[model samples]
Target: MPSFSGNEVTNEQIDELRDAFERYDLDSNGTLSAHEVRLALISVGYEITEAELYDLIHSVALYDLIHSVAVRDEDRLDLKKFIRMMAPRMVHVDSDQSLLRTFNMIDRDRDGYVTVQDVRAIMVVLGEVVTDDDIKDICQAVDMDGDGRISLRDFIGFMHSPI
Candidate 1:
């Protein structure tokens, strides 16, 4: 894990931010449109009004337009610019640690493994309405070995993969 001062940012941080942005920008349009934002929020079980969606899109677009330099003819928001724009607004200073803690919390047995039930339990704790089918799908996705359990390595690898 990397550490940062209260005001300083790094290239790695920029890359992480950009990767996250691109992950949500599924259309690869270099901009998060209203439709994309709405779909993403709804997929994550968040309900947003049209007005709220517009406000969110406008805020993100303004940040990108003002901070992100035009790399090509498309004026796409690059990694560095996005990080610079978002760093000051970051609410969680210890997100990396929090992620590790979350993983540990989900590994309830402390046996260095997580199962589909573990995932379902964690989702329930997070207030996510996960179904048995959803848990099975998640297990299929993460359990690369066709085993019943997901090792810590597999779990982390799955988390790092693109959604």
Candidate 2:
């Protein structure tokens, strides 16, 4: 998504922002906490601290434009406002080359495809426990061709998906 300095915003940008906000609304609440916002940021590869995150929420002009009128409480922020604050900086690193690198890194077998088992094993190594059903759901999501595995094409599609 491109950054806009003018008052005008495209419908596409608004949609993207809305989608992002909803995804980060973990409990389906209409508001976002600093912690939820932080997790969303980390998911997109940002290494932010609580202080810095607050600096963004408190100081950025974008925050002003995005803050909801219903924001009576300072502790939590409205999801729609959060969306506006994030949409401009919502850069998805899902380019072909980037996805290729990610796929290659995760595909340990070098068999030209990635299986749920591969990811499960990697997660284990990282001290994360992933259930079989979770892995299966993950594969189902990226296995666009129903091969029970993830291909580069499928990965690109996953990266391009709204969620």
Candidate 3:
């Protein structure tokens, strides 16, 4: 099971990356600089050390990757290229199926449905702290039937959607 979030990047993930880039690229420069990336990560509760931040900037090819091929003069980190470069690091697993398996494992009751309790249990396993309201909100979002529980199919479908 992949322990990291944003792994198993899909088209939706790419779209999300593009949206995030657009939101973070306040200047509409079509690129994200090291400082900009740092700010974005910080907003998401991620704290990178100075050395790690530098390494991440270089590893993502941010300095060399350009926003547009036609505009060769503008050397900046474009969202698409940044996504491609960082996709590997975002995911700890190699496939979406693995993530699904993890989700299944968390639905331990095998009742074909997951409730707030289920989410709480799962979060505990992942060493994450989640409030009951958070679990409830998640269930509400995924449980289209309004049954107060998320069916396996629905959960899987939600996971397939953008996070």
Candidate 4:
């Protein structure tokens, strides 16, 4: 599945999302309704329903992202924002600054630590399945100190560790 997170999105990914948006925006308008999103994903060959969209994206994260740019009209949303929010995380950069930037992005609330909710939000947003088991797996993989959270050091190690 194609995924993106924060500014880690590559130019190719942006172009692809733009193309998908254009294809879905049949009326040539910048906004999209629930029906429009359904049709757009279908056009791109995804076998999904409107309800499934909600399930695929975490409820809190998806609502927060959508409500930020929510339209006054019912079921209307900024398609671009939805696509961007759904993009997966990619931390391929190797510089210390890059690692810090990735940490900040993942930290979301600037809490200096990565929580399970934070990780699940990004994963599910980017079209990845984030089951309860997957959350535990991620914790084991990145929560080096075993404190049930990913500290700055742990996050940096995660970014630097081999994918």
**lDDT (CA) for every model shown?**
0.58, 0.64, 0.59, 0.60
Residues forming the 10-long window of minimal summed lDDT in candidate 1: 69-78
Candidate number with the higher lDDT (3 or 4): 4
Clash number for every model? 0, 0, 1, 4
lDDT comparing candidate 3 with the true structure: 0.59
Worst 10 contiguous positions by lDDT, candidate 4: 85-94
Please tell me which model should have the higher TM-score, number 1 or number 3. 1
Residue 58, model 3: lDDT of 64
Clash pairs, candidate 1, are none
Best by lDDT: 2
User: What C-alpha lDDT, on a 0 to 100 scale, does residue 16 get in candidate 4?
Assistant: 46
lDDT of 1 by residue, 1-163 (tens): 3333356645554454655666667678676445544443433234567787676545545655676733342223344434443565343434354345556767888888888778888667545686899899978888867788887666556645666
Which tens-of-lDDT digit does each residue in 28-134 have in candidate 3?
78888665665444322345665786777665454345432343433246776567555665454333454456456657887777778887885565445768788
**Tens digits of per-residue lDDT for model 2 on 43-139?**
3445566788887666444455475443365556676556555655644443355457667766899888888877787556444566898888878
Every model: Cα RMSD to truth:
7.6, 5.3, 9.6, 13.9
Q: TM-score order of candidates, best first?
A: 2, 1, 3, 4
lDDT (C-alpha) at residue 124 in model 4: 62
How far is 145's C-alpha from truth in model 1 (Å)? 3.2
Candidate 3: which stretches are off by over 4 Å? 1-13, 16-82, 85-99, 161-163
